[model samples]
Target: MLLFISYVILLLVDGTKTDETNTETDLALDKPASSSSHIIHPPQAVNDGNTGTTWGSNSCFAVQLADYDPWWQMDLQVKVKVTKVKVTARSECCPERLHDFSIDVYQEQPSNSAPKVCYFYSGSVSNPGETVTVTCSRPVTGRFVRISGKNKLNPEDVLQMCDVQVFGVAISTHFDSCASLVQYKQQHSTKTPLKTISEGIDNTAACAAACERSESCTGFSIRHLPATVCELLQGEISPSLQADVTWDSYVYQGCFSVCE
Candidate 1:
């Protein structure tokens, strides 16, 4: 019947539209990303898909001059849930040079804001020319991923990378309460505990709730007086704070709002 033909055509058109919508989303997730830096040797070698082991004089390797802070970055071009980052080090020589580096993911370039530190390598890597992969604690939404730190071998902070690969897909924003703020304290603050604002709080979760509800509170340090007690802080968190204290500190993002 004519009616049946018309219904079939309508269904076919709807199906085609659905397919096109899905294709668009897929392309958005997998679109080609880009990478760049202030300086590199044999330019464009960092993310060119070529792997190199030897460093000096190799056209396939990326090397920065000793004049600036060493850094190499990958730009995903769009904000996406970053799942993992991998770095390939040059082989057969200077393996010790890769120590004391950091892998970070940022909503934008590092110049724009303080990044979420995904991983930090402080110890020496025993294997020469090995590929180091760091899986994010959770999928972090960010457009830029950077690898930076000093080249222990060079005082001027020269750096190098053979390959940098980032893998992720477009997704919603990720909140990581599990990411603890680095250890910090106020310079004049005593190592002794601040007066507890809330006693018998039960746990850090209760302490965090108090901070979230308070407008002036920037961070909270929780200690179990055998029962949890919360000490809310007024000012910013200091990373260089040296104190002999046992309680753990949880900092709110608002503490760093001024810097951003």
Candidate 2:
């Protein structure tokens, strides 16, 4: 595969450090695998015969009320400190349009009775080859999540989910979830204060999913923008657990990291 070099920029909220390493392994986008907490509903099961989106080598499954059974759930084994999560989509020609689809994040739970949804990402009307990103502002621990939705094309009704993600330091892994986001900005703002570079979902549930999917994404952010755009920035991150940078709508954990 040929990798084109693009300028990589890191913006900080305060006294935070960004990673200089570059990796392109989007393992978070790999085919869904059944875990103790999650599973994917096969294609045939959803649309009699099929429903899927293919862009180059990346294939996203269609989410419909029918077959889109798998939740892609996992166990939030430990408390994670995270920031943002970016969900990137590939270019693909489609026979239909995907719509109302949502990426739901949850706190670690034993059943769906108490499962909480982070928020639904309003996908683009024309998602030929664009990146639909979201961010979270805190560190949350959850196990089961559901990436569900459907497409609304003229002739064919389909649902599509290309990539799911989460960000944070896993209790089972060796990562860092340091101070709150506000403090990091206070001390480092001179160097890296919280500047709105991008955005994402309303809270941290989406960010958690992005972090979990990414192999190197240490953190992620879900910033709200012009009523139409949500930015999900990732890389080396800091947990935004400060007092001032708090949210009540969803899990607001200030997380930061590489764009995993």
Candidate 3:
């Protein structure tokens, strides 16, 4: 009887450790990536699951010379609560180029606006092909993650990375049903509504369903000012759209059929 009890306790402890280990998922694998500029390799090469240090076609992502404060960014498509970020330095060339950089997280698509800094590396990488991991000081939530060069050694300091990884848990939202059907944006538009539904809407999910059912609807805006107000929009949704603290917007991302 005592042996059986000991076995059960061991299993319980092992299961708990497994659950904690699986909490963080890699959120930046093969996601849409972009950068300031590249010479031979593009930004997508860094997150292609290849850790090769060779500065070739499928190995490294390199920025052009004279590109001061160059940056590489990844779009996770959905909002994530970022925990940590990992970057691998190139081994064949100057590993010191990866020095003095900051990892930033943004709730919206990054532009000229400032972003929340998750971690900053103030020193140069000591070893080639070394993987450096930076843990956020606090819980940071955003859809976009960026790594930018800071305090460059020279004006022409170029940023080269072999691999980049982001680890986090996705934050669930009220519009999760339409998440696979549309692209969620944190901003709203000012254009006149193609149609408006101020009644029967309880939350953003219901508002998204209403827009999905309309063939002419290109996007939507939902706000809860004591009551839910949904506005179906027409035409393209641009980043220049207006931002409100109370409003959440989404753009139709095209599907096989309207969301059921």
Candidate 4:
């Protein structure tokens, strides 16, 4: 009986190890929740799970605006660690139109904030029949992904994409409401009245929450009492700005997990 029980336990352990190894490959393809700034074919065609090349006949195709800086954007809806972006090229025509393109991933829209560049292809794709996979140097976390580049052959900037497939795992970023921004200091520890500080902020929780969700905010300052208020700063607290001790300030640690 003891020998049989031991053998069963060994089998279970091996089974668990096999499951763990397959988790990443089994991850579902993250389809775009929504798409914008596309022309001709709807952006949904890219991730519609169809990779056929019958453009105009088959609805799964995407084309962007011909104007300069034209781009295609997709909302992943939730933060994900994007491992790779696979783009299926159009075989019907104009394959060279997609030359010099970039794939950008962002927590916020690229227009509002700087995006992390995942992969860039400067020349024309080597193969029009095969899927072109752009693997990020490291997995990036973001809710939105944008593919933008110039159409070197055309007079205007344009891009042609099909079957836009994204592969990755979901992740969450941490923001402590009770914790004060660590890098900030009180602007006036001795003289500035809390009422004179700003208005609307009441506690560290509210102040921290506001800055935590903002991609542009790097640190913040708050005051207490009659008119509790908070002021958000764009970047890290600079030495010149840190000299002011009138308001309470804290800096974000800016921690996030990346792909190995």
User: Between candidates 3 and 4, which one is better according to TM-score?
Assistant: 3
Write down the RMSD of all candidates, one decimal each.
20.9, 18.3, 15.5, 15.3
Q: How do these models rank on TM-score, best leading? A: 3, 4, 1, 2
Off by over 4 Å in 2: 1-19, 22-58, 63-82, 95-98, 108-113, 123-125, 137-139, 150-155, 173-260
Worst 10 residues of 4 by lDDT: 1-10
TM values, all candidates: 0.47, 0.40, 0.59, 0.53
Over all chains combined, what TM-score does candidate 1 have? Answer: 0.47
Model 3 spans with C-alpha error above 4 angstroms: 1-24, 174-260
Report the number of clashing residue pairs per model.
Answer: 1, 69, 0, 14
RMSD of 4: 15.3
Worst 10 residues of 1 by lDDT: 1-10
Winner of 2 and 4 under lDDT? 4
lDDT of 2 at 247: 21
Q: Which has the better TM-score: candidate 1, or candidate 2?
A: 1
Give the range of the ten consecutive residues with the poorest summed lDDT in model 2. 182-191
- Put down candidate 4 lDDT per residue, 1-260, tens digits, no spaces: 00110001111011111254574331223445344455656767676666776577454444544456656777765466678887777777666565688888888766687888888877886465457778997877787888876454655535666667777764422232222335444452222222232555678667766655553455566767556777665532544353454466655543443343
Off by over 4 Å in 4: 1-37, 60-65, 172-260
- Per-residue lDDT for 141-218 in model 1, tens only? 566777776444555334655666666553211112222333333222232433456555887667765654443355
